[model samples]
Target: MKITLFEQAAYRYLPPDFAEHHDSVCDTPYSLVTHDGMYSSMRNFLDELMFGARSGFDGIAVTEHAQSSYDLMPNPNVVAGILAYQTEQEELDVAIFPMGRSLGKTREPVRVAEEYSMLDVISGGRLVAGFPVGLSYDASLNNGIPPIDVRGRFNENLDLVLRSWQDPKPFAFNGRYSQYPQVNIWPRPLQQPPPVWLTGVGNPATMQLILKRGFGFTFFGFAGSKLTAQRIFPRFWELADEAGLEHNPYQVGFLQHIAVAETDERAEREYAEHVEYAFHTGLGAIPPQMLALPGGIDIRGVQALLRDPSDFGIYWQMRQASLRDLIDSGTVIIGSPETVADQLTDLCRQHRIGNLHALLGFGSMPRELAMRNIKLFADEVAPRLRNLWQGSGFEHHWWPERLGGTLRRNLGEKVSA
Candidate 1:
């Protein structure tokens, strides 16, 4: 397994009763955030990502969330640019994995491609580009993209991005949502094309496309691994089997929230409320309506989700969920190093997961505790888990070439515009 550091730039100080008074995203009042608090939260987050790189993480990952009080990262690439040059200058071989610009929500698709290419070039060819369809609230509420058009836009945007990366000659493009003439970009990525990754929940259509296009499929386990793994992973492999594709574990990645300390008791004492704060004020506060607008999910997807809501895990109760509730539901794992390691091991083994995005720094977790978690996990837990899939005989095609991935070009599909 490849253990990476996943983090979010969350506002560090919110009023204790902020959750009761406001939602955490889109419309959270700026007045609730102090000027210094904003600066420190952002600065500390960047420092921590560097710390993770120096401390021996294989990669550093972050996603985009605009106009959100919890995660202030409107564009993850800005931070990625800093990481790219810093890590390169330091000669750190860690991958610059940005769950990059949301295609579905972005108006300028060419800029997105240019940004990733530049990041890869500066990082010496170590870039794992993540293209998510985008969160509903961020797309619809913040960017004014119609919910029904999000997926369609994602399809077109993704095709344009890949073509822009690998296409040798400038070409004209005509599309429903985007139109470009003489599409040529400078300083193409140093890796021919850096590895591409796509994230989704349980959307079968999304999974099918990820498989058909031959990109990495990542699943975020914020809801809770135990609650979601069985439901989502099986469906994924089933689709792969149906499509006559080998079940390469590296084709899949998972993200989970984690915290660790000297003992289980101490872990809870240190991280419980922070974890609760993450859920209650961050994800929990995102109204369900915002997650799935009227046309966000297809009719069949709606039916399937309604029939088996277990894929969502503890999200339904997150608004008022306690720390014990978060732990019990597996949404946030709080324990000793051994306990945390065991949980992660079992999770990866059971799901045949090859990429583990260990989200160590999260909502309101102070820098000291966050650093402690990163250090202790990197020391004790990551080592035991990193070798889980090494001897499994499967290749990791999804990782960046500079990081030892034997990447093949789009499964031999031609780049067309």
Candidate 2:
């Protein structure tokens, strides 16, 4: 299994009473921020990523969010550039994954292609590119995109970006959302195209798109893994089976929050408060309407959600949840090295996940505690989980080639543009 350290650059100095007076996204008061607090949040984030790289993580990942106290990064590529060059100088062979620019939110598709190509060049071909369809609020409220047109815009922008990277010569292009007299980009990716990944919640259309087009699929367990994994992952592999594709585990990636200490009791004592802070003030505090704006999810998706509502897991009750509530729901895993390793291993084995994105720093965790979590995870927990798929007769087609990822040029039938 490929285990990477993941973190959101959350402003860690929110007052303990933040959830009562403020939401985490879009309209959160900037007056609540101190210069030192903002600086420490961002500075510590970068330092911890570098620390993970040095501590032998297979990769270090960051994500993009805008107008949000939970994640300060509006553009992850800027950070990716810094890590690309820094890691190169330090000879750290880890992948620099900005998981990454959101397509539905950007008007400049070619610029996205160009920036990714540059990072691949600067990092000597160690970039794993990720493209997320913009979050509803991030696209519409934060960037002024019409919610109804977000997915349409995402499809068009993705087609343009892929062609921008792969087409050999300048070509005339006409697109529904964008058009250009001649399409060309310099510094095409060092790996033809660095392996592509898309993030999703359990959307079958998105799952079909990833499988048909030979792209990697990543699922975030912010809604709680145990509650949603059985529903989401099986449906994904069932689609692969329907398409006559082998269930190659590496094609799937999962992101989960984890905290590890010397023992389970100490871990709860140390991390319980911070874990509560992460969910209550961060994800839980974001208004539901912001996540599901009009025309964001398909009508069928919304209807299915209304019928079952199991897909959202414990999200509806997260704001007032205690540490025990979080753990019981699998929103975050906390324990000793052995306990964390055991739960993660079983989760991956049952779900057939070959890539593990371990979100080690979150909520209002202090710098020292976050660093310790990263260190302990890398040193103890990760080693136990790395060999889960060693002899599975499958190659990790979703990873960068420089990092022992084997390329499989054809995965299944291509999705129509």
Candidate 3:
């Protein structure tokens, strides 16, 4: 199994009653923040990411959100650029992953292409590009894009981006979402295309596109993997099969909230409140109506989700979710190193999850405790799970070549029976 640290730059000093009075996103209160608090939060978050890179993590990841209290990252590429330079300076061979900037939401697609290309160049080809269609709220509410046009905009913008990176000569792009009289990126990516990855939320069409276009599919499982993975992964692989693609595990990535300590009891005591804070103030606080606004989802998809909301798993009740509710439903894994290793290994092996984005830093977790958790996980848990897919006969096509990924094609031949 390949393990990496996935953290959001959540402002860590929200009051105890933050959830009772304010939502985590969109219209968060500025009265809750101090300038020092803002600087410290962002600084600490960056420092932690650098710490993860130097701590022997395979990769470091962050995502994009706007006007959110929990995750303050408006542009993930800026952070990715900083990581690129830092890791290159330290000679860390870790992938710099930006989960998404919402191609649909972006007005400047060429700038997006330039940033990733520069990141690849700076890191010497260590970039795993993630392009999510985007959340309804973030793209529409924050970026001011029409929810109905999001997917179409994403498709057109993505085409423009890929060609912008690969085309040796400048060319005109007549995209519905964007138009460029001359498209030529100065620094082409070091890798052929830097391993394009896409996020899918149980969308058969998205899954098919990931398989068909040879892009890696990443599933955050923020709702709770145990509750949603069985329904999602099987459906993903089934779609891959129907598309005549191999069931290559590397085609999939799953992110899970994880914490570790000397004992399961201790782990819970230390992490439970933070975990609760994460869900209650983060995903739980976002209004559901804002999440899937009409036209944000495909017409049929909206109907399917309405008829059977099981795809969302335990997300509906997350606002008042207890630690036990989170753990039982597998929204998080908090335990002794032994316990965490066992659970994570089983999850990867059973689900054939090639990439594991272990979320170590969550809502309001102090820097000290978060660092301790990272160290413990790196020392105890990561070592044990590193070889889960060693003989599984699968090549990791999703990782950067400089980090030991094989050629992107014919990966299915390695799948061990």
Candidate 4:
């Protein structure tokens, strides 16, 4: 299995103490916590990414969000640029920005895609493009579009971007939200088409689209269990088969929070504090009012479920049971390196999961703690997993290595070397 580390770039300063106070005292739709400073958080996150790269993570992941404490990477391309430059010097594939939240407005996404393509050329095509039909409220608010229209726009935007990347000559695209007469996108992605991964929350329609389009599927595993994944994965495979595409298990990626330490007890103790902060503060930032808007089933369901505390007991119980099962089934893959590796191996063997994307620095985990977890996971856990997968006929067709080398050679020693 190919292992990639995902960092949410959660602000390190959003401590549990501060979050508890906000829960009890704050009443506004948003809170400007002291830890929301951008520069320090970016610096720390960059440090962590670099640390991960040095420690031998196959890829470093970045994502996008807006006006929420869950993640602060509003412009993932900028982060990608930084990673490309850093990794170029080290001569390693740094799969940086997976641009998210570009639902429609071909101009912006096309421009961003063009820029990323240039970055890919500079980095020799190590870029991985992640597209998503973002949550209703944030997508609408940030893009100055309506919540209801986001999905349609998202679909159109993705089409335009893909066409722009693939088409050699200028073309015209007349969609509801975007109308472009000239579709000439310069600096075409170095990797023919840089790997495109679709981020979803188990939306059947989106999953079907992904399978039909032959794009990889990446899901957030925090909200569901192994059974949830099992339910979703088979449908994805069925859809892919129906779409007449090759059934490659590597095309499916799952994201989850992971923290490994010397022992399960220490890992749980350290991880629980951050997990609680994530639940209370990170998730708390999403106003109940915003979630009430119309959109995908998961968001709508979660919103409806959260409406009445009494009604949530069943959901909570299911969620708790699911989480325990995930832990037992080795789906979440947390705890000591030995235990985590054993579980990860079993999970891969059982589910035939090829890509494991681990969200390492979630919640308000301290920089030191986050770095320590990265080091331990890389040193102790990754080696064992690598050994297990070695000679197992798992394809190592990672995108970064293929595209990034071209960028390095073109930019010469100063920029790419």
User: Which candidate comes out best when scored by lDDT?
Assistant: 2
* TM-score of every candidate: 0.98, 0.98, 0.97, 0.81
Candidate 2 on 21-137: residue-level lDDT in tens? 999999999999999999999999999999999999999898889999999999999999999999999999999888899998888888999999999999999999999997889
Q: Identify the runs in model 1 with alpha carbons over 4 angstroms from their true place.
A: 411-417
Residue 71: error of model 2 in Å? 0.3
Which of 2 and 3 is the better model by TM-score? 2
Residue 202 of model 2, lDDT score: 93
| Residue runs of model 4 more than 4 Å from their true location after superposition | 15-31, 35-38, 97-101, 104-107, 241-246, 284-292, 295-333, 387-417
- Whole-model lDDT, candidate 1? 0.89
Note the Cα lDDT for every prediction shown.
0.89, 0.91, 0.87, 0.64
What's model 4's lDDT at 139?
Answer: 68
- Give a tens-digit lDDT track for model 3, residues 1-417: 678899999988888888888888888998999998899889888888998998999999998898898899889999999999999999999999998667878889899899899989999999889998888888999998999999988888788888777777999977777788999888988987788888889989888777867888999878988999999999988887787878788778999999899999999999988999999888888878878978899999999998999899888999899999999989999999999999998888888898999999888888888889899999999999899888878888889888999746332211111
Lowest summed lDDT window (length 10), candidate 3: 408-417
In what order do the candidates fall by TM-score, top score first? 2, 1, 3, 4
